[model samples]
Target chain A: MGTWVQTMLVIMLIHLTAGTPVWAVLGQAKASVEKDRAAMGGQVQSKLAPGYSVETITVVGMTIKEYVSLDGTVFAVTWKGTGVPNLRLLFDAYFDEYLDALTELQNKKPRLRRPLMLKTENLVIERSGHARNMWGRAFIPSHLPAMVSPKDIQ
Target chain B: MAYRAVVIACLWFVSACGSSGGGNGSAGPQPPNVLTVTVGGSSVCRIVNQLCTQVTICQPGTSTCQTISDILVDTGSIGVRIFGSVLSIPLQQEVESPGHPIGECVSFIDGSALWGSVQLADVVLAGEPAVTVPIHVIAPTFAGQSPSQNPCNSVVDSDPRTAGFNGILGIGLFTHDCGISCEINDNNNLYFSCVASTCGSIAAPLPTQVQNPVWLLPSDNNGVILTLPNVPAMGAPVLSGSVILGIGTASNNSPPPGISTFTTDQNGFLTTIYNGTTFAQSIIDTGSNGYFFPDSTLPLCPMPDQDFYCPSAAADLSAAIFGVNAGRATVPFQVANTANLLQTGNAVFNNLGGPSSSFDWGLPFFLGRVVFVGIEGQLSTLGTGPLYAF
Candidate 1:
């Protein structure tokens, strides 16, 4: 199965079980703003760009912004909040790959203790925060639409 | 044990010298069981605020021993971990399952982890000898032997160049590195048993876990005392000290009357209240170069230096350290602009700090102070184990 199909299946499963369409952070189908507004229990707003649309959701004590391609795919996710959201829940199936990449990053810089920035063939992640205040951004490099830069994910 | 304790106590008064100067070059009745700690000595890699000591290792129990210098003395962690590339002599590898060697993935608060194998070696610290204890041998090859499913297999230091030090001597406030967590849980992922080329995550029994060689000592095993000379307000190129093994067991390491003792929880964490915010999981980590604490008032250095705080002026801050009990201490610390400090090419700074989740009283906090690390489940004159006393 294609990566999108597998991710779509996982999203469908989560929606079916939880009665809410949960969008994966980096690689799910573009979210239905109405469903997201209800599922997250917060306000949902969006802005359409030339090639992609940016949807912002404020909920769970964290503000998350998702970059959606015109064809309907969440290519990136950025979040800022008091505490880091569980990556397993945020990235879904892609969490394992993120972890693998993180390990490789540590191997390269064994003494790097702060300001984590990771870039892999498939993903890009940056995390920096202090106590009770955490923020980060993660994006699927291949899924990012044309004219949309990874820098825009932030 | 009681008879030995009695003998040591009697010798403390008879053999103890009254010299106040305890620098690395102290000429006053140097004990045979002692090691000199150079804060910023002849280490090839000049990482700032590092407390380093010399260690002698041998193949289990042989005449062959190599005294390796530049071993970082860390009170924040437990056990001895040496890079495989630095080892001149080979040690016997320990196995968990039949014909399967034990591997470990050690994680730090910084989100960095090390993948390595556990080997049995006779580790000599200062003049104390610990026979047949499990130690970590960091190597990228061993990481491949571990199961792919294992979380630690994902992270492996490619070479010793990135490791900074020859090895790390973790004589923290614990007996074992992973302790009961890895002992009872099979999925802890810290420990693994490799059969042939396939390694699987398994529960590492307490006896098989990487141990604190200090705890395995024949005498003076209660704890350790680290005394580093005072660095100037600006910074210093080099500083020196002594990492005396065993607390109260040795005359040179006994805590003075009214010595402040702050206890820590299972993970070696205490509480620190600074700037009206209470950081519940504060740790005194000598492994960390600077005093890492979160303070919004202090400006963060731009981009690459963002990990450290960059104040217009060196900010002198105070925090109250609260123990598990009612024990409390108010400590005054400083955080200087790391970028400007780096310009001077100084390796030891008294006012260096960084940004971290919780309060990390790092190596800078150890300067000019005699710090005692009380090991868990052990007894010292300061009361019980698992306490940081100054």
Candidate 2:
């Protein structure tokens, strides 16, 4: 059927270096060869074609269950890198342990307040080593990539 | 020492459990080594699916950043959904298992089921960094229900500007949601089962739905490479680029220019042919915004439900290059016409994910374009295999 759909994606990199769990991949790529300088820090000097500076990392001490966060851009900045973000964070952590009693009746019902008001922020990104830290995730682990074990899977 | 024992096991690990990130990246024989990160967007027109164009994101805590306009940058379902009950950062859903509440019963292509929840945030993507991952919050909606179920009822269709798109950023490669088959095959599959009462267990599929997060990237997990700007007369304007992450990491990502690399069979699905229709599978999702298939006949776009349209009509969108045997040259688009070409309906306007058979080119086919998805078993000196290209 297309090779049986390619045999379900033919696994085994140790299934990802022995099936993940190294510090959860915290970071490693900065070997000091130093060579990422695009004229060192944008803005004071203008347009060499500048456009696309997005960054939203937050997985260290997670907190964003259930769903619905509107107003606009509901989805699609998706530059690439899948696992759909980690299957949407394992379905938002199994829907935050199963929607805690229907959002706790919208958080203990005050006539179900209106106009959307949720404030539980904690998305501090900047890690690498495969991302599993949370000292506020400042992680500059060197932009990740260097754990290739699994008898070297190639 | 082991990188300081993973920062002392990230403070006794267990924390970052699931808010987002992971759908399929990291299984191997080869494949991994990709990092192309590109951002800076605009294309506005959304009036409930009339001309859509967006990519703004700012809700880390919000002072106002919502514009996720004509999104579709999916890698096949993982996270980053949006539709609202009230927002800026008010979207919630929770419940992975305490009683199973994150609620919702997904399975679109317009068959209808996309309930909601399994959400969590901190996913800012532009040049790579903002990472809290776990996303899904899709929203055809629910709040007492009534996001309105109209096949063409409201007209622009799924509404969000005629589904021209405002949402869909499934950065492929794998990490969560059905990847080991929802954690080791259940076969009932709602991703393993979930229907209502906040949703949970009722499915029984082998691969009916749940398949994109872009092959799963720890670095180009495998298969992608869009690249556009050809214009061909504004026919490809949904443009943008830089999802180069992994597929053996660089040498220009190797394998290109005609499409057909084929590997995924065990559930990653990739049967090939597209545009002329041969189909066995087709999930390279960036969260599907186009290239869906099903049919009543052909020349699609007409809805009430059921129409991948391939009676043979085909016209409106049609292309098929895909390279694997020789390596690289993707194209793989369709439904420009020819019935049943890319099936699925309920008319979110179009593209729900093809009639059971599979053909999800989503990510607005990678707007502005510059695609190169590879990672599934990497090699890359320009060989081995995975796909997508410009």
Best by DockQ: 1
Interface RMSD values for all candidates = 8.2, 16.8
* TM-score result, candidate 1: 0.72
Model 1 chain B scores worst on lDDT over the 10 consecutive residues at B1-10
lDDT of 2 by residue, A38-151 (tens): 111111111111121122222212211111012111111111111112222222222232223223323231111011111122111211111011011111112211341211
Error of 1 at B287 (Å): 0.5
Per residue, candidate 2 scores C-alpha lDDT tens digits across B1-390 of: 000111111111111211122111122212223222222223222211122212333333332233343454445444455544223444334444444444333332321224444554444332222333445554544323333431111111233333334455544433344343334323212332233422333322213233334343344345555443322211332323344454445565555565344444333445556457654445555433345544334543354222224323334545453443443243534344312322321112232223423344554455454555544345544444433334
**Tens-digit lDDT string for candidate 1 (B255-288):** 9988888887655668999999887767777887
Q: Per-residue alpha-carbon lDDT of model 1 for A58-114, expressed as tens digits?
A: 754457777889888888877664334435556766877877777665544214344
Q: Indicate the residue-level lDDT of B115 in model 2.
A: 45
Give the best candidate by TM-score: 1
DockQ of 1: 0.09
Tell me the docking grade of candidate 2: incorrect
Using Cα atoms with residue i matched to residue i, what is each candidate's TM-score against the true structure?
0.72, 0.26
